[model samples]
Target: MGTLLSGRARAHPRELARFVRLFTVVRREIEYALRPTGDLLHRLALETEFSDFAFLQTVDTRFRQGEPLSDAWDAAVLALQTEKLLKTEEIALIQAFCSAFGSTDPAGQSANCAYFIDRLSELQKGAAEAAGKKSRLYLALGVLGGVFAVLILL
Candidate 1:
């Protein structure tokens, strides 16, 4: 059970790392290139190597279908949540980001992305540490269990 939880915990950091990278890209595109979000999303959908790249495509499609950008983003995040890809706190953070995104000037947009990137990075680090601790704890428990079984058998 601990091993299972450790594995699940490991995935949290990986997903957060992907989001950190994604938002970093957003910040760069908005701050340096001054590109509109639609183009950026389309490009990211095509170019991102992450397993969750489909969410970007989904957001792009939803946005093109006359939905608000935030709504489209929410739909995509909902998909992630449905897949158990994000925890509750992560989802809330993403929802907050969705609300703030594209609701301001280019500078503010860039700043928002940057801020989220930092936040996601911090979460990723914490998740990684948790996973490591869980892994070690589980390994120790498993060894102890095996020793107990061996003694009982003897």
Candidate 2:
């Protein structure tokens, strides 16, 4: 009976590991799907604008019905869908990952998901800062050139 109980306990961990694996794949898919691209950002902005409109509509409805909070779920879902658009190749990659390791533990999966999300956010922030610096440098150079030209004329 002790041996049987030990086997059962081991099985639980194994099962949990499998669920975690599934969660990891799903999280990775979500990240890849939401990766920023020039075209993707443009589309996302449009979708965000639409989402705002939908949110307003929901809020208006809620106000009329004397509800405190709006029915914002639909708008949020729409926005999420828009931002999480996946390309064919990304979708295939995610599907393959899921097929191979779909049984990961939930706790492990959540940890992995959070790690990836944080990493992605950090990368995005770095990229944005770099872009902002470049823009500022270019603007300063343009202003200096304009001043130089005026001095030469004078």
Candidate 3:
């Protein structure tokens, strides 16, 4: 899942927006009709069109197989980290989310999800800005290098 998204993100900077949308949907779904975490994950696994569908499915499966939600979420996040798909800030946000998730009442869990979603959205914006700046910097460097080469030739 992260594999596919990482590659796609390289080609389309808006890929992280998909992740934002995913979290928003999760928040909305849970808030609409609170259910058990495992059941919520199972439903998201079936309904989500995001690249993290596999991650959600794996967590749901592991939870059903007797793993704790935090443990399953940790394992899944670790797998995503190994793929290098997440930034350091994003990783910290996700870890915080896992720690708080399932340890609270349904309302609290929903609020936790909302908090993380907002944090993730902010990180996404920063990343997009950084990517844009780096692209412009690289473009300027390329142009400068071309001009220098032409001057040297003359």
Which candidate ranks first by TM-score, i.e. highest? 1
Overall local distance difference test of candidate 1? 0.81
Better of 1 and 3 by lDDT: 1
Worst 10 residues of 3 by lDDT: 4-13
Q: Score every model by TM-score.
A: 0.81, 0.30, 0.71
Writing each residue's lDDT as its tens digit, candidate 1 over 5-90 gives 66776877888887888888888888878777777777777784743566677888898898988889989888988978677888
Cα lDDT tens digits for candidate 2, 69-125? 213323433443454432233323323332322235544444556654454444445
Q: Alpha carbon lDDT of residue 103, candidate 2? A: 37
Ordered list by lDDT, greatest first:
1, 3, 2
List lDDT for all candidates, in order: 0.81, 0.41, 0.70
How well does candidate 2 score on lDDT at residue 121?
45
Pairs of residues at least 3 apart in sequence or in different chains that clash in candidate 2: 16-105, 17-104, 17-105, 18-103, 18-104, 19-103, 19-104, 20-104, 20-105, 21-104
The candidate that wins on lDDT is: 1
